[model samples]
Target: MEETISLKENYEIVKKRIWLILSITIIAALISALVSLFVLTPIYQSSTQILVNNSESEISGFDINDIRTNTELISTYSVIIKSPAILDIVIEELELNRSSGVLSSQINVKPENNSQVVSIIVQDANPTLAAEIANTIARVFKTEIVALMNVDNVSVLAEATVSEKPSPIKPNPTLNIAIAIVVGLMSGVGLSFLLEYLDNTVKTEQDVEKLLELPVLGSISQIKEQEENAFVSSQQNQPVGSVTIES
Candidate 1:
């Protein structure tokens, strides 16, 4: 015969270990909150906007073809901006001790859609350094592109600035705690079920019936120490019976 478990049985299993489940979940959330608050490093991000414009457009007036050309060149500009050709100068100018490969990993270049504007984004542990790196990268790219591509159109539109109260872009404690809670709850439930399955001792009539596959004829009630002592005292306090003989 196929065996099956009802919803009541599942509820009972979870109820039996409710405290264990709750303890594990609470501990997991607390650990996650602590790590997010103190253990993980906060990474701050800064971005600088650079515009790719046709210098001749100012003299010769605006043209759609020039705009399209500048927009198309943005893809190439993005690559060059991250290449050693540009980052090397940026590092040297800023006197950064890190190598180009490491610095390049921290930088991201993105071009605005259908526009001749490119954004240089950098992330660092220090907010001030993040802003400084972003601005330095834009400046270095603008100067070097003129020499490398023979174009004098690139200009810094907005420089990255550090706010008085800059917030880190990641390590959100709320999100981490939320995820930890879910994971912990799932783990607790799984462990609860596992422990229930591994336990073979029968503590209830249902367990005995299930294990033996037989109906119970009777069961003995368990008496506590206090109840047993009370029974003995009542028996001793009873008057001794005297037998009377008929004369």
Candidate 2:
């Protein structure tokens, strides 16, 4: 037979196990909050922009051809900015005790599509260092690109700056807690239904009828030990009336 449960039964199941569900959800959220606040390392981000222009006159010597040429150069500039040649000088200037590969991993170079602007982004545990690294990479790339590519087109457009109260980009506690709450709620509801389905012990007439597929004739009412003993004591104390009846 295909078994089906009504909404009321589901509600009852959830109501019966609501405490368990709540406990699990609360524990998961707390764990996530703790991990986000204390266990995970926070990362700070800083970015600087560099412009590629071949012409000295920004207003008059510009044309569609120049724009197209500069746009094409941005792609090459993105790669050259992250190259060891540029990153090595940046590391030396910053006195960073890391290899070129490690420094490259911390730096990201991206060029705006159909534009002459390239952005260099850096992430680190320290906000000041992140800004410094981004600005240093831009400065080093602009100085070296003239010698490496033989084109004095790269110019620092925007420098990265550190604010008085810089915020970390990663380890967002609110977002982490929100995700944990959703996951915890789902897991709790799932576990509640699973436990209800696995429990096979019958405790009521309805359960008996459902399991046996038969109508119950009657049921014996359960009496507590103290109540049964009191009833027996009352019967024994009523002895005078019985003796008069026998005589």
Candidate 3:
């Protein structure tokens, strides 16, 4: 038969298995920490910003409509930044041991909203190489776009550089541990509830009364074996009803 439980009983069940729940949470956190610190590869990222022409002053001999056109052309320029027209030259200039496709995969281009500024970002296992790629891609894209479009509109706004201490941008350890802790706690509580639901043994007089629908005439109290033996010996040695019994 099935029965409903109150919040107090649920709380008691969890309290009884609190250690198991805590152990699961700790194990999950430790595994996440280990993977974030040692197992996963560290990827370093660098970014460089460039500017697209918004005025004829930035590029000689252009009218107001041309300025708007150039601003709209920013999206096309973003695509060309990763194309072989730019990346092939970049690979040859830096003597990098990667194909144009592979090098392009590590780079990202982003343009400012309703503005002429563009940002180039690159990621690599080596920190110095990441910065070098970011800077070189911007230079090559700027020079190549001039030749391709017959306009001098691109300019470097900020260059990517390596600091004294560089940090990877992926596999955030603390965040990972926090998520694992929440998941582990939820799993443990669910398992505790499931186990409690599966248990059907009668453990109390109330359970018997409810299941059988009858009054309990009496109950046999439990006694330890040593105490029972001692009580029996004492009873055997004592007189019953104030009359000595012969053995």
Candidate 4:
């Protein structure tokens, strides 16, 4: 016959194995903490902003409608800021060893909604290098656009500064360790139940009765003192053809 266990019993089993759960959780948390703090390298970020104003000016000698049209082309300018034409010049001028494509990937350009202002953000391990790259890209883009499109509306709005305190944007150790602890606790509980299921030893009278399907007349305790005494008396007495001992 199948047996049913109560919620209380299940809770008891987990309670009995709480130590295993705690041990696994502690180990996982330690590993995660060590990996996050020591094994992984921390990365820093810096950003620069550029303004894209297409308003016609007296010095530029461009028509108001042409200025408006150029203003609408801010999206195109954002894309061009990261293109090979601009990035290549910036790389050559700065003597950067990275390729145009690789350098471009480090840049993110976005224009303000319904406005002509474009913001360029650069990220690198070194804050000064990041700011230099951002400023260079903006200057190069501005010069190239002025000559190529006959428009001089693009300008640098802000420059990135070196942060006094390191800005950590990735590899959150606390969050990682928290998740690892939860996962480890769950795994430990699952393993405990699995081991319990695989165990086949009879640990209680109920188990013996159920397995044998027979009534138990009586149960007696085997006393160690009585057993020892009986063993000693048997050795002292010599046996005849048939031997018997009284208890």
Candidate 5:
């Protein structure tokens, strides 16, 4: 036989586990808050901008095709800026003990879309270090571009400054808490159903009827202590001759 459950029945099942859901949600929210606020370390980001321009001011004997060629090569500059060649110099200049690959990971270089500008972003635990890395990377890229490409058009548009307050770049607490709450609620509801499935005891007349296919005739109410005491007192006050047994 196919077993079907109604919406009301499903609701009743969930209602039975309300306390479990609430407890899990609360615990998950607390854990997420603690991990986000205390356990995780905050990272700060700093960025610098460099402007790419055509150094040929006079345009003397400079073909428009040459200008197009240079414009198309902007992407090449972006890649070179992030290369080990430029990053190695920046690392050496800063006397950073980190390897070139690690330093490269800390730097992000990208050029504006069809525009003559590149943005370099650096992330580090210390705001000052982040700013220093950004500035040094930009400066080193500028010098290297002039020497390698013979283009003095690269100029530092903006230098990253040390932030007065450290801004966290990851592990957003609000978002994390929200996710945790959702996960906790789902887990709690699932666990509640799992427990309900494991429990085999029948506590209600409805369960008895369902299992034994028996109809309930009547229910006997349990006598309270006060009612029992009153009956005993009435019997004790009655005379011995007044008590008679009916056949």
Candidate 6:
């Protein structure tokens, strides 16, 4: 059977150090919020989709061969979109100071499974630049594929538009704070248990009996300072005409 803690023991543990636990949790959440808000760079993402089917030829019936061929070719198209062939041209056109390698790292080409549509997603610090890059990548890939592979089937299905107010897709503040709270709570509880375990000084008569493995015959009552001083004064007064009065 799994070991279980009594409710009273759990309550005592929590009550003993509730302030420490709350302080740690609140501090952790605040730190996480601050990091998400100001410390880390916010990355804005924009996406554009490209359709890799015959735009010229319109068919009424579904062609399995063409569908399979289009889906299979989309994988190669994904690689070509990120290759230096297209990215280098895009860099020159955009006049971006970054290298093709750096730009490639920020771009992601994701193709839908068993579909001819490919999504070109760009992430940048500037929201407008991210949207421009996404659109430019799709436009550049369309132009380059015809020259590189003599293929003209690829076309931009939807152009990327810049948002007036774009939010970052990374470093989610709420999620980060939630995770920090859990981490802080665990750390606080673990530290509390560690401190409890390390504390071994006896505090009760039962502890003395348990350690000595003998019955505790008696325990000395703790004497207050006032009572001790009175006893000493009475002893001094006994030599100078004093009478004892037992309570």
lDDT of 6: 0.88
Q: What lDDT tens digits, residue by residue, belong to model 3 across residues 82-167?
A: 89999999999999998999998898888778677888999998999999989998888878887898777788999999999999
- TM-score-wise, the better of 2 and 6 is 2
lDDT by residue for model 5 (18-50), tens: 998999999999999999999998888899998
Candidate 6 per-residue lDDT, tens place, 55-139, comes to 3555646788877887889889988999999999999989999999999999999987768899999999998999999999999
The regions of model 5 sitting more than 4 angstroms off are 1-5, 56-71, 205-247
Candidates ranked by TM-score: 1, 2, 6, 3, 5, 4
Best TM-score goes to which candidate?
Answer: 1
**Candidate 1: where is the Cα deviation over 4 Å?**
1-5, 57-59, 238-247
Residue lDDT tens for model 2, 53-109: 875545566488887888988878878878898888888888989998998898888
> What is the lDDT, from 0 to 100, of the residue 196 in candidate 1?
91
Give the per-residue Cα lDDT of candidate 1 at 143: 85
Candidate 1, residue 207: CA error in Å? 2.2
- Give the clashing residue pairs of candidate 2, or none: none
Between prediction 1 and prediction 4, the one with superior lDDT is 1
- The CA lDDT of each predicted structure is 0.91, 0.87, 0.87, 0.79, 0.83, 0.88
- Model 5, residue 82: what's the lDDT? 75
Estimated TM-score per prediction?
Answer: 0.87, 0.82, 0.78, 0.69, 0.78, 0.81
For model 1, residues 113-194, the per-residue Cα lDDT tens digits are: 7689899999999999999999988888888887898888899999999999999998999999999999999999999999
Using TM-score as the yardstick, the better of models 3 and 6 is 6
CA lDDT, candidate 4, residue 5: 62
RMSD of each: 4.8, 4.6, 5.0, 7.0, 4.7, 4.3
lDDT at position 218, candidate 1 = 91
